[model samples]
Target: MMGFGLSIEPQLWALLFAMVRIGAAFVAAPVFSAVSVPLPVRIALSGAIGVLVVNTAHIVAPPEIFSINTFLAVAAEALIGLALGFVLQIAFSAPMIASEVIGMGMGLGFANAVDPNSGHATPALGQFLSLLLTLLFLAVDGHLVLVDLVVRSYEVMPPGAWIAPQRLLNIAMFGGYAFLAGLLLALPVGFLLLCLNVVVGMLSRAAPALNLFAIGIPASLAMGIVAILLALPAMGDYMLVIIREALAAAPALVLG
Candidate 1:
């Protein structure tokens, strides 16, 4: 059966083919990739996005449905999608890394809980920053922006076309940026904690009879909490900037 002189079968194939990339992107993306996100929901969303792409963009179906070329095309599609999502994943990791440094500095490193995103045990502070980052991600409708990039990516690098080597280099470069960003994010609180530790050390040297653990532990914990509260506003702003910059860089890797 044909609709308006167009075969429905080919369109269905194109739709299915489109889903390969969309599905892979969802699997690798941040919020969408969380353990809390159900598999069925991911499938539905991928199908929905695939339908949108097929409707809005012109996609050609492979002449042969079963062949080596088709398998290669599938791999290319997955690669592109993973690269796109990996960019945001790198961005999200900055907060976790920052939390680890701050927690250790404040003697709160042992406080661990399962991360909702990856299901691994993360520092309590890391989890907090991760939640904050998640909120910021939604507040900016970053998911929508990422989906838009996924769609636009088809236009720039269609299925079967290889991804740019420069984009892979960009991802590697961005990993270094994540470390730098995390360090900067923790700098304020870490600095205060360092000073607190130094003072505690001096006090211990002054009074040998004083129980260093009893005094130093409490002081470090109290000071860490206070430093965090005072530095929170600035840290939040830094996260926002990181989010925006990441969003900005993501499109370049995919579209440009």
Candidate 2:
């Protein structure tokens, strides 16, 4: 019995390395990484997937479970997993950025509420947009894609593969795209509000006696809400692209 168990030690270590990457991905991925998920649950999920990876991928057995090389491979796996997770993390930032832009424009920035996902007091628009993005994320089955990508990583990079410099460059480059998408998501509402503000400024200039307070505030509020409603369909389309790009980028980030 002792010899039989010893013979499988290398296989078990390989599974351990695989779990490190998956667990790191879960810790870093957007929806899965939410503070709301208990650590024990995340670890368990990683373990389950790790078991699948070892069975399906036919990963090479580790040299020694307690050796320095095994530790290094585990660290590399974690790094790769984090890179995969960071791709989605970047994608999820778009809605938050848009929310901030629209919220500040609508004078809703001061209206703060606790975010259930993050437990932070974000502006009202941020909360609304977060909810919308969350819905869109689930609607597109992005969560499944995230899981699939991590699983695919085991096949592509496997354990003990060298991390390439270009992959790190790609991760950095992806951040630029994330910021651009965030701006694009926010642009419609932000621009419309800017136009509204200009009109309000003109009104204030033309008639100093006009109760700009009474007139402009309600006007901006109504316009902001209308703009958001008008932008909804486009926002959904934007999210579709964002999720696709994020999922596609995951394998590159993890494997490279």
Q: Point out where model 2 deviates above 4 Å.
A: 253-256
Candidate 1: residue pairs that collide: none
Q: What C-alpha lDDT, on a 0 to 100 scale, does residue 22 get in candidate 2?
A: 89
Give per-residue CA lDDT, model 2, range 1-256, as digits (tens): 9999988877777777778888999988988888888999998999999899988996875667788887787788888888889888887888877787788888777788888888788777877777777788889898888888889877788777757988888788888876788899989888999999999999889999999879877888899999989988998888888888888877766575
Give residue 193's error in model 2 in angstroms.
1.1
Question: What TM-score should be assigned to candidate 2?
Answer: 0.91
On lDDT, the leading prediction is: 1
Could you give candidate 1's per-residue lDDT for residues 1-256 as a string of tens digits?
Answer: 4574467778888998999989998888899999999999999999999999999888886888899998888888888888888888888899888988988887888999888779999898999988998898899899999899899988888778877788788788888878988999999999999999899888888988999888888888899899999999999999999889888887786657
Off by over 4 Å in 1: 1-6
lDDT agreement of model 1 with the native? 0.88
Clashing pairs in 2: none
User: TM-score of model 1 relative to the true fold?
Assistant: 0.95
